[model samples]
Target chain A: MEQPEELIPKKEVLRLTGISYGQLYRWKRLGLIPEAWFIRRSTFTGQETFFPREKILKRIADILRLKDEYPLEELVRLLSPEVVPTEVAHLDPLALAPIGPEGRELLWKSGEYAFSELVALACGAEAIRRGAKPGEARLLVEVVRRAEEALRAPTDLSALLAEKTVEREGLLLRAPLALVGREPLLLDPECRIKVRLDLEKVVEGVKLALGGEGRG
Target chain B: MGERNVTISGAGRIEGGSYGTVKIAGSGRVVGDLVAEEFKAAGSAKVEGNLKAQRFEAAGAFRCEGNLELEEGEAAGSLKVVGRVRAKELKLAGSAQAKGITGGYLRAGGSLSVEENVEVEIFRLMGAFEIGGLLSADRVEVELEGRARAREIGGEKIVVRAGQRSLGGFLSQALGFLFGQGSHKELVAEVIEGDEIELEATQARLVRGGKIKIGPGCRIERVEYTETLEVAPGAVVKEEVKG
Candidate 1:
């Protein structure tokens, strides 16, 4: 079986992080960790638990770094990907690191922004950072905003900025395409890929930025 | 007196509502969801829907059809929950059966049976248990009078003693009548991981921990320890790797 993301065994994770089994399971029960991340697979020895390499490592790191400052319950609110701050009404989306000055060009109007709008702004800002045209960034924002529900489960979601160029006789017409969908996104042979943004990372970044703001 | 006290001294049924104290001395039933400051049931009682109470005490058969959110609860007879049970501290004397139980401290005397996981801060059991999924806690102490089974058991400090039925044959007989007959003082788990683990009459596929002590009558397939490993006589460990 071919997995798109690398996986690490449960034992290896404990050894690498020097965390105890108690801490791992405790975090899991407290919702500091997502239940879906625990992937049990049958190995030659016996049944074993595995995790997505990057996601688990980063989540454990975040928890360890913040556990001292906040209680486990508060840490869940701050760090758990399962917890989307749906009630957030941020006054300045640009102040968030993920949606900085690059988002200025994409902001339609900004008195107060909801969580989904902030995520949209972040997507646009990230696209702009990747050298996308302002219009293209706006298009990506529009594509990602409707999929705000994805932030709760934020896994295997991809945002594609593509172009389909049609040439007839001596004329060439370019149509910029923007779409958000689950991974393994198929495209037409004529469509050239411009930027492929992983929505999971973008969503995590926005969540963390919002969490920081909450604490401050 | 914002008086809302439901007292059913005999066989009766009442709709669920906010009550100061619900005292059911006889067989009774609650129709809908219930939120009460305190609930005291002496005879057989059943809650058809969810229940939220600050304090709860029941003597006879107590059954909850829906989930129960309790601050403190103590039951003398059989307690069964069809859905998950979330309590700050729960003590059951006879037997407890639930879909899932997560709390701060849980102490069960006779038996505990759960379909999913029981994640708590401190778990202490005297007689026996059957957990389909993981049973994890900060500190797990089990004095096995009969047999227990779990898919996986993990914690910080785990100590399982065998045949510590200090209450003698009376309670064991009662427990046998409730749960099952005494087969052996043992625990069966696929994996048992903790910081400090001490086992007696435990059969596990893998036992991973630091400072592990395996006592008599334990049959472990493999043990991977970091600090130290001590196995007493009559314990079978197929493989042990100490780091």
Candidate 2:
């Protein structure tokens, strides 16, 4: 008799990525994320969580382009069920700034990058413009950073979740179903992707097809 | 005291550890402290010291130059401040609205609205909150809206509609993305206005009240509701899901 494919545990996937419990289940239900590959263990902690290389990679790519224009349920339906790998582009520079007196010192030493950009980098100015608190936007920025890193190298998912800075903790890495691949993922208009002015103009020319502004 | 009225002019101060009910009219000044179950300042009242009260109301123009603390006992009152205010916690049932509110902790049963400008190092709310300026907080919940800018954001169901954008709509999208996808429970949303809705990083059963129109600008995380979902042609979605 032939043996079935080895299955990975969900816990392991979460531990490897550091995504939140809520995110994991949300993705699973959306179908953007595949079902958990469970493995029975013999030890006391007799369960394991594993994800397919392709499935997780695809999700990472899709999440990076997350937007707030469409309902989550609808997005799942619109997304293509295909997997393709892509190369990692240049690592963007992330800026952070200190707030309080203690944080001011951190800024003097350049340890603080521009958090404003980080907020803009995550989803866009929609949240902030829509009255989302700075702290809330900052969290989403960090999450986006982690998501990007994971997409670049799914195998080294650990590195994608490393500390964003000395004082900051990279908790966003814990979200489940980290995807990393070259599959063409749709970029939501709500995401605050900082596109160069020249590139933005070009994108605008192309985006006219959909009758929307492409000032990313 | 039933409804006794006390009027004090400029530079004068009133001192009291505890009272039944004190009503201050005109530009009454309090230098010492006031501890009562109910305190109302009609015109402009300034307190240099702490003002502890069970129920506090500032109708027209009220200012708190010092800390204002309230016990959990008094949680069924509207603590409204029109003028400048500096209090710790204005515990009330309705909402806490102030021009300039500076304090440590403020717990409100209803919404927390800060008109003009508000500068607080730490502000926490239990219901929908709206701020005009910078609001630095460790945690937040329900719905939130900042007219100008928001320093940080954290909440389960938050709606912040400012400028041309809608805060409530953004929150609904984020919630849908995080909780609405293929969730065992339904993620329902009712929009009485336009036909545009987006869900990002949320999961739950979704039910829209108006025409379901998804924009190309949307980035959804998941969607797995028990019932079928209907969408208008303009809707653009990109995510994953299962039946």
Candidate 3:
């Protein structure tokens, strides 16, 4: 199908990109998403931004590809074309071509792979930001494993890894128990703990909050 | 006290006395015992005797000219003493790196790294404890590693690389180790929330969201809800014992 030249509405853009309206607005403000690609409304209060169909789709594809390693600013720097004034007569009219069909297909497949990896990476980054060592990422493994187990077996789901005493014999990693009743663990946005479980019963206990998958 | 900030400097002694919140700067030295609500010392301060405070912060170059002590109403925010600290209870929130002997109980909410030569005469924990230095205690309890000196002595768990002539504690009670060594009984949790906590070597329960590697010669009690948990062959983890 021949793509339209005008910018797509917010709902359509969000449907294509799987991003929220708030995220898109923030990205635009941060220059992660190009302002040139957006069509602004003529009015003030009712003003809304629209994404050009091709440009928005391309940006979505690029965002999916680079979400793992690159931040929004870096992605913009790499993908956005250099702007030249129309008054310059000797400027090159050369425009960067969109990723080809084969490339786009590869990117679609790569999106799935990137999604899972980005989830794990995002979790890791959050942990480190909280002053945890990189090696502490294993905490998520147990979380994911319990989530998987819960999906596989439809039991109580909150009694999987109960807190049990284990001797520190020949063990390499000791579990930190400083998060009993503090911050609500955000297992994605919807799932959050209202009450904390016992520290000892946490292991093998399965009140896990799964992210993106296994929520059903 | 009404939040009075007192500064001690230049080879001074307060004998056996008390204050509100002390802010020691500029090569200050205290020879006698001190009791205060809060104490902060920086720039080559030396405390010759015991110190008891509600909150203690020692930065820059500090020396425990004598024994160090703290009480339930006292604590240390960040303690870095090159010399020995012999107290009944030592609680720290920030990083603590002490070389001298810790005669009494030691507790911290943050990371604890000790030099190879220093010995923790008594190691106790209300939080996590990380020891890169020598630890010699009757009993030890920490969320992370117990004592990781280059050559660790007897306690409960001794897990570190490149160590010889090390004596590990054998089991007499449940879980292969006794729990009564002037140390409280506490388990590591995946997440803890408070003003502070200490990380221990043996029971470093972590709330992980990403990849983690339990290093060689280390021990893990439990790992709750994380992305990945990779263990080296030398690492050991005991099964969880449910109540």
lDDT of 3 at B72: 36
| Residue-by-residue lDDT tens digits, candidate 2, A142-178 | 4434453333222212111111212236533322121
Look at candidate 3 and tell me the lDDT of residue B42: 66
Give the lDDT ranking, best first.
1, 3, 2
Provide fnat values for all models in the order shown: 0.62, 0.00, 0.00
Model 3 lDDT tens row, A1-216: 222355676546665666543355445534455545556554332334466676578667766776676666555444433211112121111110111121221121222322222222333333444444444433432353333323222211221111223347765443432121211233333232222222211211111111111234
Question: How many residue pairs clash (N, CA or C atoms closer than 3 angstroms) in each of the candidate models, in the order given?
Answer: 0, 80, 71
Off by over 4 Å in 2: A1-216, B1-12, B71-148, B159-243
- TM-score, cand. 3 vs. native: 0.26
Kindly indicate the candidate among 2 and 3 with the higher DockQ. 2
- Model 1's alpha-carbon lDDT is 0.88
lDDT of 2 by residue, B1-243 (tens): 454334454435577566777677666767667777777676666666667776676654455544566542233324444455554454444445666555435555345566543333234443345565434322222222221123222111232221121336644444344334332221122111111223322222221211232332222333322223433344333432322
Encode model 3's per-residue lDDT on B1-243: one tens digit a residue.
Answer: 455557767545444467787777667766677778877776666676776666666755555644465543223444565555555566565446665545445555444556543334345443334344334453344442223222223332222222121335432121122223333322332222111121223334331212344555445554322234556677665532211
How do the predictions measure up, each by TM-score?
Answer: 0.91, 0.28, 0.26
